[model samples]
Target: MREDLTFTSGGVECAAWWYPAAGATTPAPCVVMAHGFSLTREDGLASYAEALQAAGAHVLVFDHRYLGDSGGAPRQRFRAGEQREDWRNAVAHVRSRDDVDAARIALWGFSFSGGHVATLLADGIDVAAALLLCPFSDGVPRVLASPPKTVAWLLPRALADMAGRHVTVPVTGQPGERAAMNLPGEADGFAATVRPDSRWRNEISPGLFATVAAFRPVARASRIGVPTWVGRCADDVSADGKAIGKLADRAPRAELHDYPGDHFAPFHGELPTRIAADQVAFLRRTILA
Candidate 1:
């Protein structure tokens, strides 16, 4: 069963969908999930949500504050800190639900939110388990992967945006375009996951770059005490494998899985079918068991 819902974070209402497990008993264990980067909950996450639900875990998928159907001002803004807070608030909202089992709460984060999962665990939040898929874990590696000139060019724009004279830039662009994540195959990867009715924006306020640059989710890996699973694509250009691996290794109970395809592979087509099986196996062996 699926239901629509909302919860407040930072004084803003965040939109979400609650998927109850097919054969769930009352107070089912729930997996709290959210999109990454400039993504909305509508962007091909339903497959993942459904997969988790089929495994007998309730799924709660939501949009971050200021994105998608959620409430916020000035729109299309990205802040790692605020998003982490949103994750915390989301989990709090889940606990408040009478239908959820607070003792079995879990988390699932995709792409950018994957890193956020690390932040949540780092903060010592209690959860039965967690899973992060194709997460962008480190900032310096991403910046180093981008063109030096583009990084230099964006610094001023980022500063300007922080100062409230906001400057927006395309998230991905051609080689010489003034964009933030304009790297090889980046545009194609983004295009592949966009659903037909997606409301994701191409442009975003750049002030978050400074925040992103300072975010090193891996640094807090050692603080996570719950069972965890981390999935990564071997050739993922959008993130650093070493960083992700190190984070997984640092987490005392983290398991890492490497897939063959690129970053977008798990989000589309037959690949999701395979990835879902792996994720379900993990949940069964760890949290849902």
Candidate 2:
């Protein structure tokens, strides 16, 4: 069963989708999920949330302030700091619910917000546990290292943003037209999992590039005292796998799971379910212990 919910953050009402644990009556452990850059709460999160709910955990999946179904002006504008606040807001809302155990709450993030969790840990949010899926940690370095198709448009756009110029880059054009971050196989990767009706494809504001460069989560990860798990797609070219591995090494309590596939493959092709299972099993042994 699923329900719609909302919470206030930074004076804006943020929206979220909630999945209740099967047969759950009393308060239960809950996982609050945050999505990656340019993705709405429904893009690929529903699968994981539903799987976790079936595995006996409540799930709260929310959109970032300025993206998707959430409340925020200037759609698709990326703000790392504000997004962090949104995570805290989502957690607080989930914890306040009558059917959730405040002490047993877990933070889940993928890609962009995957790194956000690291920052949250640095801030001492006190979650029972945390999960990172193909997270991006050092944005500045990664953006610089990104392919030209990505850097070409993203860098200039971010610069335009710095000068207070609102630059709009095309989301895509030709069949192989790049969407800033689509690597050699990324277009195909996106096509595989994204439904034809999915509207997530787009060129994010150049401001997003600026925010990414200024964001750094790896340095703060070591401060996390909660048990942490990092899942990686060994073949994920979109995200910096090496940096993710480093985050696991830096965290006080951490483990790494290297799945055998590309980034989106793990989101589909038998991996999302497997990853969910691993996440639930790990939470059971670590947080539920």
For each candidate, what TM-score against the reference? 0.97, 0.90
lDDT over C-alpha atoms for residue 274 of model 1:
84
Query: Each prediction's Cα lDDT score?
Result: 0.87, 0.79
Q: Whose lDDT is greatest here?
A: 1
Q: Weakest 10 consecutive residues, lDDT, candidate 1?
A: 260-269
lDDT of 1 by residue, 1-289 (tens): 6899999999999999999987977888899999888889988889989999988988999999888889998788877788888989999998988988899999999888998898888898888899999888898888777788998999889889899885788887767787887887777778877787887888888997866668888888899899889999888888888999999999999999989777777887788888889999998887678
Model 1 misplaced stretches (Cα beyond 4 Å): none
What local lDDT does model 1 show for residue 42? 89
User: What is the Å distance of residue 94 in model 2 from its true position?
Assistant: 1.1
